[model samples]
Target: MSKLDKTNEHEEHTPSSSFSREIEKEPGGADIQHCIQCGMCTASCMVASVTEKYRPRKLIQKILLGMREEVLTSELPWLCMTCRQCEERCQEDVSLAEIFHAVRNIAAREGYIPVGVQKVVDTVMEDGWMLKDGYSDFIEDDRDDLGLHTDLGWNNEFVKKIKKRFIDGGNKK
Candidate 1:
């Protein structure tokens, strides 16, 4: 038998099928099967433009070949800026951004989130906001300074009720 046929026969009985099954469980994975191996994505990627090692084409190839560990652990997965440039440039409209998002979620589920991303997640969880510098402290100009009436029937009671509802609903972090 030919080498290709022998390899296929060997893979049929191997644990590699489990990795294939896991990849199938990913949402939109069916789209991956339709990839034509065009290098447009890698050509248009800004990261790939600057970095010799960060090519989306190589990523697609690895995923197609079921290189689970390499695809998941590579810095290339986290290097995506989510710019959608690759998606926009794709002739197949393959949703590369969605694929990257799936990869990131898988990495996170496997407890592989990089320290920088984990710090951002932790800050958001703690502050209920993504700003690392905390809320801006701009002082509101007084009504007198703006030459307007200070008491224009603004209802403090209504504002208080809204604040109480938000706090009770666990949204007041």
Candidate 2:
């Protein structure tokens, strides 16, 4: 047998494991095995419409093929907007948005968070909101000055608790 022929034979015979099974082992990955690659999810995806790199259909295919590492490391998981449109459109009723969120959390726990996401997380940790210095800094007027009837309050304790519960818990919510 020739070397090229042997290599081809081995490649053709490799058994594919279920990447969906691995992801579904996690919290938000339920129903991932139901995906049937109907392309409806991708067709309705706002991110996919604007960017060629983000495609829910393709992501499902990669997962079904057991490309766990590639799916987790690539920006594909982060591109989802969690709109649930894909889930609604899915013929198999797969929760694509939830699955994406679950995968993103896993990636973050593995220290694979993108720089932009890290910055937002740091901001949330520092302040009660995701914006740095809080939203008050962006506005020039106080509640009283703006003639607002209600008063705005900042609870540092609440922010601390959230950090301890979420971020410190390895981004597991």
Candidate 3:
């Protein structure tokens, strides 16, 4: 109610920054300024539903506020499923999934990737799949039980080309 209290309230709020504006200059990243903090994206996020830590709404706010290191170093950006459910329901039509991807790209470039993500990349690069290379003894029995072919679908040649495209191409996927 007092003048001093009003001024303190204004000072408590940090200013938005040009980081998001810079990102907006890139393709598919122009909607950063349109976020209204409505929490719709958070509510609709499949990851957010399960994890209290991976809120895209809060991440966008941090980006607009220029908390670059915090957002870049955290595992939050990698957690996005890119399902587009948040974008579909957003009132401002902000490309939430794209924004997340942009942040992830930035983080990855800076060598801030989480260990789990690195493992996934390594697995795909080495085997063209998420699981470990080579088949298990039980796998054949399971396939037979389901009346399926015994082919484990490990195409070494195709995997080699994929590895060259992604790993040898400066991580281009």
Candidate 4:
């Protein structure tokens, strides 16, 4: 057999153990196994409409095939805007948004967070809530003039507790 022929063999790829099942155990991921690769979800996806790289059906296929590492490390899962357009069009009732979120949970725990997501997490950790990265020094002067706290009134203690309970506990998100 030619080397290319060997590489193309269907049997060369072995599905990992229960990668789909792992997602199924996650919230909103239970219906993943029922996906029939109908492509309806992809047809209805707005993200897929706008971007060539984001394909919902393909992601499901990879998960069902147990391409665990590829799925987890991919930025495609995070590209979903959770608009539910795909979910509405899905005949199998697969909750693609939820399934992707579940994948994100697993990916985050594995420290595979995308840069944009990590920035939000970092902001929440620093200020006890989300603040724009451009929150300027001049805002302090304005707050002082208005007799308001320069450090917005967000509860730092709550953020800290949440981080300790979630991220530090090995279930990082």
Candidate 5:
């Protein structure tokens, strides 16, 4: 093999054990002791299987090593679908999905919520709904569609009752 070819081969085969150690220092870091390094989480992760750089196993390694800069800022962190497939497949019950959430939460607290996710959060905060469109768009006349009685006055009464119950339950806010 040529010199360049040899370098490429080394890069492809070398495991990132050093980086894995840095990740372990992170808050709510993945339990490295629990990981068998069996690659089951990576095998089951939809994000990892599709994106070579976003492997859950690698992420756990990163967390173990305290690689906060790389772990928090990487697009790979946000790419997780939070499907819990890795969690389900792990014989160790490592809760990779929860680990992903913790990482994402840390990123968000540090002002790293991706623009796409930030936009969704903004919409929900402003509209009290996931979609940005007006409430009229969601409200419907059909009883089945509304999931309640079609009578508008009855609906108002129902809402009042709910509000009263909430207040009585000390949920005034």
Candidate 6:
């Protein structure tokens, strides 16, 4: 191969370190540099098996390649199930859950949250949790079919204290 051609190929594949560095600063993402791309994480990832777009190894590659905007702006980071299957099988002991969580934190702080994630956050902020406020109609029917009690013995005082400590504290009006 010509010298010019070789130089061009080298320039094209140069490793961009900024994004990886930024991720390393987050709480659980410090272990990202240890990943060896051995594919064990991918092989053990339940999300990767079912979803064509949610490959954990590929996500790490993106960050390592300094694809900062692409990593933060995409819905791919939000697809982690946090099952820790990949972490368990990792050769490098990298915590995929922590990395994903850190990515999600960055994404949220950057206002890049997907619609479904925003809805869950809104639910948690408003109701102190998701299921309690959403478990009336369809959930009750399922519970009845299974011979379970449909009446929700909810604790309003607990909810009130949580709202005071967090939800109410945040609101200006």
lDDT of 6 at 15: 48
Q: Write the per-residue lDDT of candidate 6 for residues 63-110, one digit (tens) a residue.
A: 988899999999998988899998777756678899989998998898
- Candidate 6 matches the true fold with a TM-score of 0.69
lDDT of 4 by residue, 56-93 (tens): 99999999888999999999999999999987777656
Ranking the candidates on lDDT from highest down gives 4, 6, 3, 2, 1, 5
Name the TM-score of candidate 3: 0.69
Tens digits of per-residue lDDT, candidate 5, 57-156, equal: 8777676556778888876778878798887777666667666777787788788777888888896664344642222313445655858865555356
Q: How many pairs of residues collide in model 4?
A: 0
The list of candidate 1 runs beyond 4 A from truth reads 1-21, 134-173
- Go through the candidates in order and give each one's C-alpha lDDT: 0.65, 0.71, 0.76, 0.79, 0.62, 0.78
Q: Estimate each model's TM-score.
A: 0.63, 0.69, 0.69, 0.66, 0.58, 0.69
Worst 10 residues of 5 by lDDT: 7-16
Model 6 CA deviation exceeding 4 Å by range: 1-16, 129-133, 136-173
lDDT: the better of candidates 4 and 5 = 4
List the pairs of residues colliding in candidate 2: none
Clashes of each: 0, 0, 0, 0, 14, 0
Give the TM-score (vs. native) of candidate 5. Answer: 0.58
Scored against the true structure, residue 173 in model 1 reaches a CA lDDT of 27
Winner of 2 and 4 under lDDT:
4
**RMSD per model, one decimal:** 10.8, 12.9, 11.3, 13.3, 12.3, 11.2
What lDDT is obtained when candidate 6 is compared to the true structure?
Answer: 0.78
Candidate 4 segments exceeding 4 Å error: 1-17, 128-173
Whose TM-score is higher: candidate 3's or candidate 5's?
3
Estimate candidate 5's alpha-carbon lDDT, on a 0 to 1 scale: 0.62
